[model samples]
Target: MNLGYILVVDDEPEIRRLVQEILEDEHYKVAVADGAEPARALYQKQRPDLVLLDIWMPGTDGISLLKEWSSGGRPEVPVIMMSGHGTVETAVEATRLGAYDFIEKPLSMGKLLVTVERALAAERMRRENVRLKRAAEPDTFLIGKSALMQRLREDVERIALSESWVLIVGEPGTGRAGAARYVHYHSARSDRPLVEVSLGAVPPPNVAVKLFGAEQGEAITPGSFEQADDGTLVLNDVVELAAATQLQLLHAFQERRFMRVGGREPVPLDARIIAISDLSLPDAVAEGRFREDLYYRLNVVPLRLPPLRDHREDVPELLNLYVDWLVDNERLAYRRFTTGAVNALRHHPWPGNIRELKNVVQRLLILNRGDEITEAEVEQALGGRPRAVDSAPQTLFNLPLREARDLFEKAYLEHHLGRTGGNVAEVARLSEMERTHLYRKLKNLGINPKAVKEP
Candidate 1:
């Protein structure tokens, strides 16, 4: 099998043939071009994993060609410059133009081979980082000791061992995407790409091109399907897809191949599909919002993620995990949660689920200067009073009338704020109060409108 595809461009036929032979012998698929025009055409036709360009080609020189490629942001592939009469200034210009490295000729096969390997490795790492940022959280491991969580872990592990398509259904921010990443990392295809497409974020008109890729003339844009070949392709918020797109996807799955938006050739679908949605597929299909045929195809292995409130027993562990993670990764100051604070957090209803809890932890750490976070601080951060777990008369009843009224008002306003995602005007309308007065009340209660907004 070809290790990687490479394009070698040199004015001399002898040099081109020698370089091509060397790369081909090393198990690479090599394409050679004698000048800038052919190199451009070759690059557009089939984008190579790397490019080896000669600096002194006739017509459009290497520098001009490099400039043209780099004009549209950074070049997707690495370009290594080659020149027999190389100068420091020329090398610097090439480097500034985003060339991977500059090598003097006659080329040293040893150095050339090593450089090629490093360039490919670096590109892989870059792509991996981008994929992780888009598709995963900082911590992909499911953190909990509750029986519900333990069973979920076992189910995810078992599903990872299979090649069948997976459908993950859960409430928003319930770690659905994180669960997807967990499966991909534990599966046999861990070394391959994990491409995620958030269908809800993409426009309806562009969803097809985003998923199946697009080919306009020689310019090719590989979509999530092509990028995740031999690996996992996560379709996030799958319920957001239009009916037409759903039908197209169903046909592709049925045929085990897909055609690009503007291309005739069929590309085999080699990816493991992992579809995620906050709503159940059956519910979507019953409501006529999703395709029934596609639902059955994708739901071969279904995984349900429990909300934070269902497994409230794991709140302390999650709190500690996020605290340590934030301290280490974000360089946030170390702070311990008081027992009261922990208890308060445990009793609260996490409407936003795990993501909300994480954001709350971050907000608490950044806003509070004390080394220990108290229950009052947690209450203020959450924007509402934590429900009493015990069956005793509530503290609100014990306070004086005016003080009790103030506390009730604070909790009431904060609850609406949380529900509205910190939209003051919306909260005001919901409460039947004027917007200006609502702002004043929020300020008086020490509620930060911006802080309560979901990240």
Candidate 2:
């Protein structure tokens, strides 16, 4: 029977004793409690592999207690709610409140034991995943140190101390996802599972089913939020979530719940909302695309980050940091960039933000001579003569921060695309960018290689 300890929570003494005896006879350790309050206390002291909860209780019923325990940061313990007078509504409510399954009483002993074993097996698998993740990523702290970065670090620390909703705004390569992660990690809800969804990564037709989530529909699976209760749920590239999806997001924000596709009742969300969008949101609002009200709610604790170009002064520091990381983890010997090469990095525009810079540094360390990088080497590795920007009827010093940076990003990407003859692999290899990062840059710039050829 793969016996394990189980908690039986019912106000009925008879029900509790009968269930305990049935489970104990199967070589299981059973803890009996006459009410929800006692069940919660005992479960907290030593978390059972499974819980049998009753909906009707004196002070706090089973459903209410489950909500309380989930919000209190106890992990997702598999709960099977049992009721003598179970209706469709009550069963649905129990499921929504995070019960694994609901059983109508006149309890079937064999069926109950089978469900307990299955729940325990699933619980074991979930705990194993958590343990493996902890082992792999012991130091999950945010990685970056610059003036803008320091400001972000301070923001995360401050927000972590509070439970306010967070809205992160930045360009594609500006680390919005990474920023969202930091907030969750430092917050009180760090121990719960993290649910991440990218607005641009999924198909529009299926976006709602994935984010707000779908019920066990006639077809399709449950969504991210359904799986991420009492934790952090991040929506990345939120700009791509069309008007209808934005409305759904706003509803989820305002109601603390959402009815999944083809589902009737609203599934309450206990997960914290942290959404990110690239580009200026004001433009979207002005275009009558994004809802103003939704904007206001999400902008509660706005975290605006400067792109890599604005913080060019931090380039040398980033280089040194990456080199140290490569040495420590990858066992690569430390490499140093020459003063001229560092100077070149500062002058060129980094459109892809920190991601592009990081990739370039790693490539130099691995593919080229790690020691003593030069200006000529930087120019050769990442093409587009800085002279082009200098000679474009505009002086680099005279151009505004954003304009100059955009030119650099566009020019750099165009130059690389040309160098590879629209070959992404060669472009990523020569430019030292990850394929995904490079594609993100292409999408952000609205560049289509086929269109450039046709035009």
Candidate 3:
């Protein structure tokens, strides 16, 4: 359980080991460097949340490192300077150099921990203030009170306590990425970075270097895995990874280490992997499109994000959330949803799930001037699109009785499948049929749930 990443730089081996142990006991991911040289390397590699530096050392002291870091405007991370034989002038100099605080050492463990805690808390507050001043919307949290959503949140909380790789499966617009972030925020590594890698977006030719990193001349360019060391790495659309890249990932997982491109030394793989996909992994494995072993590794804990229609009760809350977001980020005029409007949205088949619902809310707020949105306005915004069950093609009416019935059943089942994002169980419940019977009906109707286009 890593609460945060802390770099402890001290020349004395005993002092370094003691500090590392103490910090580790407090659930921080602690990295130790004997002096400034190794300190620079560790800083470049992991970029720890906070750094504890010893001012006096052979060769380049902590002051030089501080100067180097502060030279390029302000440093991203806060640094605390420590010295054994320190004067008021030295402390003031350290303070002037952008050090958060200076401590005279023969260190008091209690004070050291307290100072670290305060510094970290202050830094977090500063970041929040900056974001608010910039009018940056807060990150979307998992919002819902539906039974399915409650269960999902409980599962996420439980899973966050572990270090196992997670596989999240959902529809295209369902909040899989948001769920991953929620897990990371609650995990032991919450204070560390949550790096996201969209596997499908990365060029196939550059996947290896982008993930494992590349060696350029004498400098080593760190990759996502390295950057997310002791943190969480989210691989979005994991199924889009090429076969060769998947194999490489599998090998890295097996060995728990990987070599950078054109580099001989292996870097330890330390980040927890959270992989997300909008497709069925088992089906992909059966089709030989995804690697079985890799899938199993990532499927240590599997979570299925329910489509918006499956949790219609959450629509009102989602509407409020998105509306608040639009107000903060887009500076839209705030408006309340009338009871009728909320009920209408609750019954809407959000084919695109949360993403679609957000878009609708944004559209309503942007296009309407009223302080309260009514049902009629909602209908107008929806362009009178019929519900999934009400959307059977009129062409079916022209066929003979038996053919028309078959065509209607096919279309109906397909629409339900799309609405549920291919979840057969949800389709069964929505259609008021038993699971096995629904499967048979789908087969008889020649409706492949897998073939349905997820919104």
Predicted structure with the largest lDDT when compared to the true one: 1
Question: What ordering of candidates by lDDT runs from best to worst?
Answer: 1, 3, 2
Model 3, range 354-446, lDDT digits (tens) per residue?
Answer: 765776788889889879998988877765553533433433344334334544666578777888889999998888999987876665444
Q: Score residue 197 of candidate 2 by CA lDDT.
A: 86
Q: What TM-scores do the predictions have?
A: 0.71, 0.61, 0.65
TM-score of candidate 1 relative to the true fold: 0.71
TM-score of 2: 0.61
lDDT of 1 by residue, 1-455 (tens): 88898999999999888889999999999999999878976765566789999999889889888887776456667999999989999999999999999999999999999999999999889877876665534642367899998898789989998887899987555788788887887788776778888887798999999999887754567778877877799999787789999999999999988888997678788889999976445656876989898989988898988767788889999999889888987899999999999998898756456776787788899999978999999887765565311111134454334334545665577667777898888988999999876776665444577766432
Selected candidate, larger TM-score, 2 vs 3: 3
lDDT of each: 0.80, 0.70, 0.78
Q: Which is superior by lDDT, 2 or 3? A: 3
User: Which candidate would rank higher by TM-score, 1 or 2?
Assistant: 1
The true-versus-predicted C-alpha distance at residue 265 of model 2, in Å, is 2.6
